[model samples]
Target: MDGVILNVVTWSDMYYLDTWGRRQFMILGAVVMSICMLIVGMLSRTEGRPAYDPTLYKVNFDFANIVSAGTAVLALRYLYVASFAIS
Candidate 1:
C-alpha cells in the first residue's frame, strides 16, 4: 500500500518537473513526504493500547512499516532526481 503511494508521488513529482519545470515544488513535496513518513514510522513503533473491543480486533502485518521503507526509498530517488534537475 505504501509502495503504491510513494510510486504515485514519485511519478507525480517527475511529471510536475517535466511539465511545469518546478523542481522547487518537487523537492519540497518529496522532503515533506519523507518527514511525514518518518513521523508515521516513529508513531507506529511506539506501543499502543488495543481497541476498545480488544477481542474484536486481530493482529496483522505492519503496513505502516512497509510504507515507511518504501517512502525512504522514494525519498532517495527523489533527491537524486532533484539534484539533476537543479544542476
Candidate 2:
C-alpha cells in the first residue's frame, strides 16, 4: 500500500512538473491577488474608519513573488530535464 501510494505521488508530481505546474502556480497567484484585493476593497468600504493597511498589500505581493520565483525555478528544471532527455 505504501509503495503504491508513493508510486502514485511520484507519477503525479512528474506529470504536474512536466505539464501544468507553472500554469497552476500562475493561477494560484492570480487567485491570491484577487482575494487580497477583494479583502482590501471590502475593508476600505467599511464605515468611518479605514481597516486596510498598506502592509497587507505588500505582504500579498511578496507572497505572490515568492511563488512566481519558485514556479520559474521549477519550469527551468523541467526544461533541463527535457534537454537531457533529448540529448
Candidate 3:
C-alpha cells in the first residue's frame, strides 16, 4: 500500500506541484506527514504495554484493538509516504 501510494503520488505530483507552488506544496506535505507520524507513534508506542506477547508470540492485546491499531498505523504510514513523495 505504501509503495503503491508513493508511486502514484510521485507520478502525479507534477500536477499538484504546479498548482500549489513549491513552497506551499512542501509546507502542506510536511505538516500532513508530521501529523501522521505523531499519530502513528502514539498508536504504536509500547510504553504502557509490551506490544509483543511473550507466551503467545504475537501482539499482546485484544484482537480487535490490535487489528484496528495495525490498520490505522499502516494507513498513516502510507499517507506519510505519499505526502513525502509529493513534496
Q: How far is candidate 2 from the true structure (C-alpha RMSD, Å)?
A: 14.6
lDDT of each: 0.53, 0.45, 0.78
Error of 1 at 17 (Å): 9.2
Q: Per-residue CA lDDT of candidate 3, range 1-87, in tens? A: 777888889889988778768998798899999999898778767322446778988875332546778778778888899889978
* Candidate 3, pairs of clashing residues: none
Error in Å for residue 72 of model 3: 0.2
Which residues of candidate 3, in runs, are more than 4 Å off?
46-65
The 10 consecutive residues of candidate 3 with the worst lDDT sum are: 44-53
**Candidate achieving higher TM-score, 1 or 3:** 3
Task: Rank by lDDT, highest first.
Answer: 3, 1, 2
lDDT of 2: 0.45
lDDT of 2 by residue, 6-83 (tens): 455455556566566556645654565455445544433432133345776532212232454445434444443333
For each candidate in turn, the TM-score is: 0.34, 0.32, 0.72
Error of 3 at 47 (Å): 9.1
